[model samples]
Target: MPIFIDIGAAYPNDNRVTLVVWGEHYDDFAEMINAVDHGNAWLSVTSYLEVYEGSLQMNSDNGCDYTWWTGVG
Candidate 1:
């Protein structure tokens, strides 16, 4: 199984493209976000999307409803 973390700005903003990272474990996936925040700057730090095993886990969207879905075009 794979876990993913997404970070970026939402709609109607001069945000950067969403950054996606993959890890096999949840802890690794979770910790990576902090590392990223420290190492770089996000266009929007107010929202984040996490997915585990191809399922949406947590989404704290404060912008234009940034959500992560699996294979739905």
Candidate 2:
């Protein structure tokens, strides 16, 4: 069982990083980042897959958690 999510612009830790995915989907997001190398170009896409493990909650599985901070300070 794995969680999947679409990578998008986020202000987590003030890094302004994209979405964070777990399991086998991490690589996909990484690739997008590598392709688009520009000023805030990575902060464009939005997440699509919202469901997590058949639930509406985010579970912190150590470092395997697919949760990314999209909150504003």
Candidate 3:
């Protein structure tokens, strides 16, 4: 299975696009963001989205709201 990471805007006041990056491309993704920030004088440090390395998994078995079911019995 491929791993995925969630990335979202660091600041709401600035217009930005939230995206998910493949784990394999994480370095490239972060580099691009940095390049844009460095090249643009108007863009502030907080204008970029932060990458979340981890996620919370919710499952129905323990009072969680989510459930994943395989069709096999």
lDDT by residue for model 3 (1-73), tens: 2222212334342333334334554454455444444433222122233433343221112221111222223
TM-score of every candidate: 0.23, 0.27, 0.24
Report clashes for each candidate as comma-separated counts.
0, 1, 0
Name model 3 segments beyond 4 Å from true. Answer: 1-10, 39-73
| Model 2, span 13-33: residue lDDT tens | 232333444555546456443
- Candidate 3 residue 23 Cα shift, in angstroms, is 4.8
Name the TM-score of candidate 3.
Answer: 0.24
- The local distance difference test score of each candidate is 0.38, 0.36, 0.32
In terms of lDDT, model 3 sits at: 0.32
Rank order (by lDDT, best first): 1, 2, 3
Q: Write down the lDDT that model 1 would get.
A: 0.38
Q: For residues 1-73, could you state the per-residue lDDT of candidate 1 as single tens digits?
A: 4333343344223342343433433453354455544544322333354443453334333222232233222
Lowest-scoring 10 consecutive residues by lDDT in candidate 1?
62-71
